[model samples]
Target: EWLETLPQDQLKCLVDEVGKSGKATRTVKLPTGDEEECTFLPEHVTNEKKKEKQTTTTFMPGVVEPSFGIDRILFATLEHAYYARPKDTTSEDKQTRGVLAFSPNIAPYKMTILPQDQRITRDEKYVDMMRKIRQRVSALGHSCTVDDSNATLGKRYARNDELGIPFACTVDFDSLSDNCVTLRERDTMVQIRLSVDEVSTLLHDLCWGRQKWDAVLKKYGQSSQ
Candidate 1:
């Protein structure tokens, strides 16, 4: 059926006239052991005497056969990113949760900063701290957002996991006194505490893959995984 497009019957006739037409032609061998005869058409040239009687043809410029299918591309991407775990696991104790495994370069937001006390999101100090953190990360050419939603932190993390957020920084009451925040990694759920001053550099290295999470754990004691 695939051979229907090939002009098999006409090839023999075209080959017979190749000598008389004085056309440059060749016989190509196909992968299937079949042969195809082809020839290049002669270049069009107009003589000065026949130029007046010849009619010129008009054509549209830059016309193309268009088939831009975005829905197909989106579906293929969603399938590639889908991840699921069943309810039974011991070596790696993880719950049955669906995750979209998106790379940091492709994720919508590189990191999301969450405040332990959502009620204080409007507080002057909390807003100022969040602004500074966002600004620091954004200055490094990465996108950051504050998750001050009324939902619980775990729920927020789960929702962002589906959105492919690679890292999350938690600001709690202790941060007010010690100027330190807890950073939790996605996929592994590993948490660590580090000074606020180190958040920007740590996040930049982790997101850009300049440093691994295990290196971070070795340098700073990991709270848990």
Candidate 2:
């Protein structure tokens, strides 16, 4: 390759000198089935074309070396991150609620919509409003699910929490009148009453990580961090 990229005279001269001094020996089998060595006698002029390529590579200009061993780097990183701590069996543990703290975008449902009363469940107005909310979330590539069961609000919230749903929207008696729903954050256990039109997009942005907790707090006039 180097000789191919070099000038004619430079390549030819380098070849001539190497052929005179460099003895190229290759493996050969002996008469007794043991191995012996042999090599073709190097001819300077006969191999002129190959010589140019070699010369260019040997004297590459403005070159920089990029080197690495991928396996070695991976091994080193693993060695540094591994921890060795002894477990204590006698310690007492408190109730953790077993929550997976993920950003909203990764949640299966950004928010759980809860109808306050059993009669409100599957009511045309509530169903149509939820469909609108789902459509809005779907358009933005977010997710939502309708839980139209006769379960209590607390039970509904618990079930969604098990599903790792990050937010809950409660359609209370107030919502039927004021067109607003109660938004509950799964992690912080915080609630903010928001209009049905406003909560869908707000939860979408929150889960997508485009908006932070501070921003949500600011929007709802809640405390920061």
Model 1 agreement with the true structure over 134-180: per-residue lDDT tens digits: 89999998898888889988778877777778889888877777888
Check candidate 1 and list the clashing pairs. Answer: none
lDDT of 1: 0.75
What's the TM-score of each model vs. the native? 0.65, 0.53
Tens-digit lDDT string for candidate 2 (82-139): 3322334574633334454445765556767777768776578876776787788778
TM-score of 2: 0.53
Task: Predict model 2's lDDT versus the native.
Answer: 0.66
lDDT of 1 at 77: 79
Q: Candidate 2: misplaced stretches above 4 Å?
A: 1-96, 221-225
**Number of clashes recorded per candidate:** 0, 11
Query: Which candidate has the top score in TM-score?
Result: 1
